[model samples]
Target: MLKDLLQTNASFEEELLEEINSLGKIVDFKSNDILIDLNEQIKGMPLLINGAIKILREDYNEGELLLYFLEKGDVCAMTMACCLGKKQSKIRAIAETDGQLIMIPISKMDEWLAKYPSWRKFVFESYNNRLDEMLFAIDNLAFNDMNQRVKNYLLDVATINKGRKIIKTHQEIANELNTSRVVISRILKALENDNILKLHRNEITIL
Candidate 1:
């Protein structure tokens, strides 16, 4: 897996990759597993080799807001931030699918930053990408209506799954969108009425 990942990700120099392989350990997670929770101390940075992880933020009212996903070949900028600043994680990370990752120790973060130009570039790029995703989420919450948001969410799911068929329940969508199940059901019914989609027991087929 490391060899294949290295073929595409040129950010890790051969020497750095050797160091990483020696220091880091391979870890696996099952779907829906909570990898990290709010205010938890981050021990290492997870370099995702396959599968997906969802990043979420919780409100004071116990509501959860979906942030963005870290998929194959992606790194969690929040984890990197916590590792660098020696702080706790402000968001939660949950495995979206069974996957594996290479967990690099926090101690190596600074050494690589100073020693490897490629590593530094990769970190900055990851940060910028995450910032953009957050901004997009903020824009949707602040500006878009519920209907539009739901549609956008479906589109995103379709893209992630690489298909138009979204296999999820209305309640699941509600939880991710931080809304009531009743509201989500109503919106989905409206979409069905408009012939925009076909809703089944727990699946939605986009038209």
Candidate 2:
């Protein structure tokens, strides 16, 4: 499974692939599971095999702001920073869906960087990709209104889950968006009246 996933998604060379196969450990996570928490010591970097992970930043009052969603075939650049700097995690990572991870120990980052050109390139590209995503998040929060942000957030959820139906409660969505549950509920009700979506018990179906 690891080798096949690497071949299909990652750009690692055969030699580095062999090393990863030997050194990387496979871990599984279920939906809503906290993969990493604030101030936790960094140990290894995760290479996503399948499903989605939501990366979040902690606010001043112990709240978390959603940074971005990481899909299959992605790595967290912030996680990379933590690993390389030998520091604690500054963000929280939650499994948005059930998934598998191939965890590479921090000790091997420099080794792979020096030994494999493909690994070096992959690391740099991953960093750039994540940086772009975070920047977009910053912009969205800075300029986008709450209503548009809510709608766009639903669209994103649908796209990520590959379906029109999103299995999230208003409070959950509000928490992710760093807003009050009351605000999310009100917006959702208005959107339902607008016929943009149908709200079920705990799911929102985009129309």
List TM-scores for all candidates, in order: 0.94, 0.97
Q: Output the lDDT of residue 129, model 2.
A: 90
Best by lDDT: 2
Instruction: Write down the worst ten-residue block by lDDT for model 1.
Output: 1-10
lDDT on C-alpha atoms for all candidate structures: 0.88, 0.89
* Model 2 alpha-carbon drift over 4 Å, by segment: 7-9
lDDT of 2 by residue, 77-167 (tens): 9999999999999999999989888899999998888999888888898899999989989888999999998987898888889999999
CA RMSD for every model?
Answer: 1.5, 1.1
In every candidate, how many clashes are there?
Answer: 0, 0
Best by TM-score: 2
